[model samples]
Target: MLSLIVSNPLFGVVLTLGVYFAAQKLQEKTNFALLNPLLISSIFIIILLSVTNIDYDSFNKGGSFLTMLIGPATVALAIPLYKNLALLKKHYRVILVSTLSGVIAHAILIGLFTFILNLSPEMIATMIPKSVTTAIAIDISNQLGGITTLTISVVIVTGILGAALAPILNKFFKINNPIAQGLALGTSAHAVGTSKAVEMGEMEGTMSSLALIITGITTVLLAPVTQAIIHSLYF
Candidate 1:
């Protein structure tokens, strides 16, 4: 019976959603940043699969459907952007420049460090898209000849760290400005950080959504150019 249920595609979907819902409730009760729902649920899910002796391929049979929804979910962020049109217009230039800087800096640093460590081109390619949201990052990684699994892992770690540290970093740096906080989180952390920004305040959430979108677009467009530069300068 257990094996049969695990083999079913819907089992993966149900298990993920159920675990995430439970994790959210736990976080709500704990009110701790470290108890992040996504993070906790991810860990729990891995443990559950391991204990149950379930292969990832079987789990992904259902989980792949969830992955497909990520694209549409990303597009849905536009609704928030539309609602905050005036705020966005007010800071369009800052948003553009900040996000561009993040994309470029992220690319250069990942490329330089990976080359310095003598990582293969494929691994370097995987790390290049680590800052962007997974929806587009997977595609970027594939095109760059990266290992999609490693790209996904690195991206999640980046986002988790960004979300976890944003509040502490903000307090330490005395960054009170909502717009700057949002830009910093969204540009660095992607969607995970944006979720934390939403809890911070209206302005932070709005700016983060904007920054996240801009960061993704800029990364998509510049990844190839950045890759070429890395190839020339490092190789």
Candidate 2:
């Protein structure tokens, strides 16, 4: 019976959502910051796959469907954005400038690190878009000739870490402004981080959503330029 269920394509989808749901339940019950639903779900899924000896290719058969939902889920953020348009307008300059700065800084840092480490241009390409939303990052990585698989993995890790650390980091830095917090998460972590910001508050969610959009567009516009610069300098 277990073998039959595991062999089904939907097993990937069912198992992922099932574990995430269970993780969500735990988060609700425990109200622990580090007990993140996505984080917990990821750990449990890894363990399940390892224990069952299920290969990633087989799991991704149904898991790909969840990836499809990312676009629509990203669009849903528009609601909160609209609700907070006035706040966005009031902070438009700050949001715009901050996102732009973050993208530029991220590119420079990634390029510098890749150069110092003597990594390939392809790796530099893959690492450049790690901070943005997956949907947009995938496209940028493709155009930049990056390995899509590695890009996805790196992006996921970046998001998960961003989400998990945003709260703790904010506390440590004594940063309490909702707008700042939201932008920090969205700019550094993208959608997953934005999810955490949403849990923090409506203002944080809105700002994070706003930052996510801006950062995505900025990254799309500048990723190629950054890659070219990195290539000229290091490669």
Candidate 3:
């Protein structure tokens, strides 16, 4: 039975969601920081992956289902966004400027780091869209001459890490304002971070959703320009 479970292609994803849901249950039962669903699910999946000889591709075959849901889930955020159009209209400038800054900062910071480290151009391309959600990131990476596999991995990692740390970082930086908090999570972390932000509060969720949309637009617009600049500098 155990061998069968391990051999199944979708085992990792099934295991991951199972762990995530279980962790959610634990959260409902107790107000414990240690019960974070993302953390628990990640640990479980890591352990499973490490112990088994199964390759990631095989695991992802099953796991890809969960990943596919990301698109629809992202679109669903529009429902909440539409519901809060009034608040959004009132804060349009704040939302617009903050998201633009976040997108610009994302491109510059990652580009600068890669440049300073003298990484390969291929690696730099792979990382250029690291701040966007996986779907958009993968598409942009391909257009920018980046490795799709590397771009996907970076997007997933960025989302998971951002979701895991945002709360603490938000508190540490004393970012109590919902708009700032939402934009921070949306711009830095993408969908996963936005999920956590939505849980934090309604305003945070709306702002995060807005950030996600605007960030996507900005990144798409900026990719070509940034690519031209990078080429001039490196080529």
Candidate 4:
């Protein structure tokens, strides 16, 4: 039954949904933060891949239909952005400053350290867009002459690290405001961070939704400037 199901192209999609449903139910019963549905599903998938010796390519073949939803979901993010446009306009100046500061700081830190450490130039270029979502990150990396694979890896690492530490970082910095919290999460973890912000509350989720669009745009605009600066400094 398992082998037959996995052999079908739709199996991955079905299994993923099944896993999510089960995990959600378990979360309701346990109320354990560490046992998040995403975490559990990810672990299950990873272990399945390892035990079965099924490479990502095969899994993706089966799962690509579900993965394709990413496009529509990203597009759906624009609805919230539109709804918050008025509030965004009111705080436009601060929003611009904060996002630009975070994005630029991330680029500089990654570029400088990677360059200093003698990492490949491709790696540095890829690292420049790590703070954005994977789709945007890959696009920016492609435009900046970077490796897409490395960009994906770094983006994942950045998101996981940011999501894991966001609460602690927020407390340490005493930035309890919803706007700041959401901005921090969106800037650092992309969609994953936004998920965390949603749990924080409506205000945080609103800001996070705004941050997602703002950060993506900001990173796209800053990528070239950042690449230029890193180019001059490192080369």
Candidate 5:
């Protein structure tokens, strides 16, 4: 009975939704940044899977359907960008520079840290695209011959950390510009960070969405060059 239920595709979908809904409510009640819905739900799901003795492959049978939605969800980010088209046009140069800087800096910093730490080439490759969304990050990791699982783990952690710390970082750094805030959050955190951006304001959400898209494209284009550079220095 347990195996049969878990084998059904709807099981993963229902479990995910149920866990996230509970996490969302808990977050709303506590109003705590650390009580991030994504983080909480992920922990819960992991524990549930572990305790139930269900393997990742079994869970992913249904979870893959949800993963497929990531592309459309990413494309949905354009709605906010479209709504803020005028604002985007006005600050196009700033957006471009900031996105490019963040993407390059992100890959470079990860590579530098991993190199300094004497991590394997594959490990370095996995960490390179950690800031991008999972769908894009996985592709980049695969293309670079990195561990996709490790890359996804790093991406999730990066996103959760960004979502949790973005507000504090913004306040600490005295970042008042919405565009700056959005870019910082989106570029550093991806989708999860965009949720926080949405809470900040409409403009911030729009800019964050735009930043996410730009950062994904920028990372994809830069990953090969970054990989070559890392190989030259380390391999």
Candidate 6:
């Protein structure tokens, strides 16, 4: 009976939503940076699955539906960008340059560290898109013949780290400009980081939203090229 319940797709969906909602409520009550919804919910689900001996394939049956929603959810971020259109136009060049640079630097650093650690070609490929949103990152990982599960895990960890640490890093680095803060957060952390940016200011949220979109596009376009380079150098 327990196995039967866990095997249902709706069970996976309900478990995911329930855990996330609980995590959100906990964060709201605590106002703690470390109690991130994504991080907490992921950990909860992992434990639940492990304890129940439920396989990933069973959970993913409904989880894939949630994954499918990511594309539209990303498109929704444009609403914030649209609201800040004038500001975006005023600093278009800065936004473009900063986002592109951040994306390239992120990829390069991941490759550099992976190579230095002597990670396998597959592992390196999985880590390439770790800074982007899970939707785009999974696609890129699949294209590169990397493990999507590992890519998603890396992306989640990166976003949580960015969201939790952005404030401290900003103060330490003396990054007071809203635009810079948003771009840095979004480029490095994706949607999870953008959530933290929203708490800072409207302009910062808008900029983070724009950065997330642009970074996703940039990473997708660059994935094949990066994969080829990795193959030549590592494979």
Cα RMSD of all models vs. native, in order, equals 1.6, 2.5, 3.4, 2.8, 1.8, 1.8
- Rank ordering of all candidates by TM-score, starting from the highest: 1, 6, 5, 2, 4, 3
Error of 4 at 19 (Å): 3.9
Cα deviation of 188, candidate 3, in Å: 2.0
| Best candidate, lDDT | 1
TM-score of each: 0.93, 0.85, 0.77, 0.83, 0.91, 0.92
Tens-digit lDDT string for candidate 1 (1-235):
9889988999989999999999999989998777877788989999988998999999999999999997898788678778878887988999988999899889878877866798777887898899988887998999999999889888888998999899999999999999999999999999888999999998898888889988988898988888888887777
Measured with C-alpha atoms, the lDDT of residue 48 in candidate 5 is: 90
Model 1 alpha-carbon drift over 4 Å, by segment: none
Q: After superposition, how far is residue 9 of candidate 3 from its true place, in Å?
A: 5.5
Worst 10 residues of 3 by lDDT: 31-40
C-alpha displacement of 140 in model 6, angstroms?
1.1
Model 2 alpha-carbon drift over 4 Å, by segment: 29-32, 74-83, 168-173
Please give the distance, in angstroms, between residue 130's alpha carbon in candidate 4 and its true position after superposition.
1.5
User: Candidate 2 on 45-120: residue-level lDDT in tens?
Assistant: 8898898888888898889888888678667756766877898799999999989989998998897787689879
Sorted by lDDT (best first), the order is 1, 6, 2, 5, 3, 4
Q: What is the alpha-carbon lDDT of model 4 when measured against the actual structure?
A: 0.79
Q: What lDDT tens digits, residue by residue, belong to model 5 across residues 1-235?
A: 9999998988888899899999999999998877877778888999999998999988888888988996787677567668778877998998999999998898679777866898788888888899998878888999988999888888988998998888888889898998889888888999888988999998788888889888988999999898888788877
Q: Give one digit per residue, the lDDT tens place, for model 4 in 1-235.
A: 7666567777677767888789878977985555666667767887988998767766677578876775776678688889999989988887788788888788878876866787667777778888888767777988988998778777766776777788888899898898889888887788778877888999887777788778988899988998788777767
**What ranges in model 6 sit over 4 Å off?**
77-83
Model 2 residue 38 lDDT? 67
lDDT of each: 0.88, 0.87, 0.79, 0.79, 0.87, 0.87
Off by over 4 Å in 5: none
Q: For candidate 2, give the lDDT of residue 182.
A: 92
Cα displacement (Å) at residue 119, model 5: 1.8
